[model samples]
Target: MSKLLNWFKQLDENLVKILLIGFIFFVPLWPKLPLKMVDYTYIAVRFDDIYLAILAFIFLIQLLRKKVLLNKKFILPFFVFLVAIFASFLWNAYITKLIRLPHLGLLHSLRRVEYMIMFFIASSVIKTKKDFFQVISYFFISVLIVILYSLGQKFLNFPAVQTMNPEYAKGYILYLTPDARISATFGGHYDLAIYLVLAIPMILSFYFAKVRSFYLYLFIGALLILLYTSSRSSFIAYFVATVAFLLFTRKFKFLIFVLILTAGLMFTTGEITKRFLKTFQVRRILIDDRTGAVYIGQTITTKELPAGSFYVKLKDQSKGDNLDTFRNQVVLERTREATISGEISTLVEEKKYMASLSANLRPVNTVVSDISLATRLQVEWPRAIDAFKKNPLLGTGPSSLTEATDGDYFRWLGELGLLGTIAFLNILFLILKTIWVGVNKLSFSEKLIGYGFIFGFFALFINASYIDAFEASKVAYTFWTLAGLYIGYYGLKYEKA
Candidate 1:
């Protein structure tokens, strides 16, 4: 352990700077970064996971130069996870007779491997306090660029700037309000929202780090951007981070200040407050039959009357609980309409209709619910589970889930089988447990920082129930880096004193 620590302490600062520079490439790829360049590519049969591949090469060169030493001290389990996942992919390809998976598809097969390399860089390279602060500082500086550019896109109507694409410009710049929500340079609103959610915590950490007053202002500015995006997952992420931070610190005074400051901000920014309040309205619309049904059915502007019935089904006798009652009413009303119009009839008909209704309703519900309850668990999870059941040992290939199954868990089973899934699950449980234990050992301020990342991970995990954030390049990179930080901070048993 001392040898490992000493080796880590000798890591060259210049090499560390190169790794930080590599981080810059990723931000432009974020949807609506006001740039138009496809950040990754494939040549012939070879695929490049731009960020990961680049980082891996840099790390390798650094090791070769002896600027940093590569020792597999804390990386065994991560390696196992990578090997198991890749082996499963090869097994899936052999069984499924895919002829050839897309070159890019096969490229992502290295994602976990790339992530493990990042963990090594983070764990070994970030030894001294200066090295640690530099990493954190680089992160905030990059965030500043993101915030500034996103603001430029939102306010100045910055023409789309991309290295590869020019026609991708969005004219208006409001990021949080749903109608004309800006993607800046990203793929869409959701993409920008996801990046912002993950970055927000790190930005907040810098804000409280006592670096400068401008950081506090930047934090406020970022919060405004979040409000404008009106992304429920991001909002929930903020809430989760806040609650976890507070609970961990047990700082009542800070908690009260936060609540009061929040209320004050809501009072001051009528537009933002209106929109924040509007999310609850969205929740209301989701559950209400008359408004929600039209919204879900895409009949909000349809001149043609819907062929089916529209009404309510109160599942329970409960009152004063608006959302559940509204959902029940919608089900009942829709069922009655279906029966009256002969679209469907009887309890079986109602069940079928609701199930059909969910195909459309579920996406919105999932988006609001972080895609866990309505979509991931309800639809995709079952499908994935079935796929896993069929191939219990060496399941399916990477990206096979989108093609063959729907649930991530099932994707694990289909690609890796029950064996791979169990292995993956064990790794996940270990990481979460490690982070949780680390959180318990931190100073109050450090605990807040740790808690923020933990909340971000949980938020993404919940969001993954519907969408594939884990598979997404930007989210995936951020997750693994933070995971690495967590391991380094806690797993090393490095005493601050």
Candidate 2:
């Protein structure tokens, strides 16, 4: 077919520009179909890596023939950053070995360079606004598929391929009860949510630019998915990116629309919030008798309470009252109000535990009582800080930390140290600078490309504060490739001019 011939043309490495566009569509959403090794280490080669490798090999041969050139601005900083990545990696490896500390191996450390290479290839390949536009089409087409699958996954229990966790085993699909947050084709809900945080803002820009109504619908779908994720940090990131995009593009009316939509969603959101809020509230107060599970609705003196239970005096309440007593009273009052409001059936299982800290489980800092937040602050951050202090120039190597590096910036500081940190920042500075330059020169419809690059990147950056989103495979690959397209488009345009 003629379409097949055209596809061949697009895949041809001699036409590097077109081939890179093809890579954009195929790579990011490729299922994590990993190669199982006999040694028990899984080799997960992403499509981005495969296609880019092919592109590199083809371009290398062309380089010998003097048919193509890899050129771009920010070359100096980019290589320096690469060097920093390796140097910090090697330094940490040496230090960790000398100090007998943990470190991420060579493969994990060097793998980032592979992600960055697409930026260079993209910069080399794209020669016009048309090229960038075509590439954007490739990207969103893949996204639309992901969106459709994610929404579909909500109703129909589709089989998924995930190696990330035991919950997401080879034969399993990740599920949650009542309202299961959909992970779709991605590895997890957090991954899907962060990807949307970067993507939704970029897609929404098309609506304001009068590009098409289709993208607007896509944006709405993405927003629905984002809410379904229930990731608070991602919500904050998307909010920041949305505001930043509107302000930069000077589109205030849509901002108002977003605010109204958020208010609407808040009213309509069901059991998810109730269940989430309940985690912070006290539930049942046991009288130390497993058999005495009945609710008497009796007001007894503090002296009559169970021996093992906690008691604390409050400023407003009677002196002998405790947190459990306070919780029980609140629940009873609320229950009576709810009965008056509408009705909730009884005869459920007897409430067993209350979350409020009593005198027995008194924390050093009462205010920092959130268990999740407390763990991050008390355990992860301190461990990272100590790692950084040990080798301040370049901290412990990648994977050196004992647990997940939930905070990306700190991970860089702890793993790579100052040299790596500066390099990484410089890399971002250059990418942003390229996008900044490209935006001014674009036509109205085409300008969304630049807007997408700018705002989506900020969203990812914001997400990086709480998660290592930049290192996330899908986010990293697509981001670099888009930035590369922008840079390449800019270079081609300037050269002709």
Best by TM-score: 2
Instruction: State every prediction's TM-score relative to the real structure.
Output: 0.66, 0.76
lDDT value, candidate 1, whole model: 0.55
lDDT of 2: 0.65
Clashing pairs in 2: 104-398
Residues 1-497 of candidate 1: C-alpha lDDT, one tens digit per residue: 99987776654546555664456445434443332222233111112255456767777787787776553544566667777776766666665653146443465566556645665676556555565565666666666666677777777775433212234332233334323555555545445566666666555555554556776676676666666554555566666666565565465675676667656655654344544443322221343332453333323321221222222333433332234444555567767877899888577867878766644432122212222233545556776676666667766556555532323455666566766667777766777787678667767566666666666666666555444555544556666666666566655533452
Cα distance off (Å), candidate 2, residue 216: 0.7
**lDDT by residue for model 2 (1-497), tens:** 99999887655644665566567666546655543321222335555567778877776676566555676366788788777767766765675572233223565666677788777777765655676667777778878888887767776665455545543434354454435566776766778888888888778876766658898888878877777766667878888888888877777888888878865664565423443452232223322232322222234442122121222223332223244554455455645565566554453311212222122222111111223444556677788888889888877766676436677888888877888888889889877876666566667655765676688888888888877787777677777877777677665654554
Q: What shift in Å separates residue 388 of candidate 2 from its native position after superposition?
A: 1.1
Candidate 1 TM-score, true structure as reference:
0.66
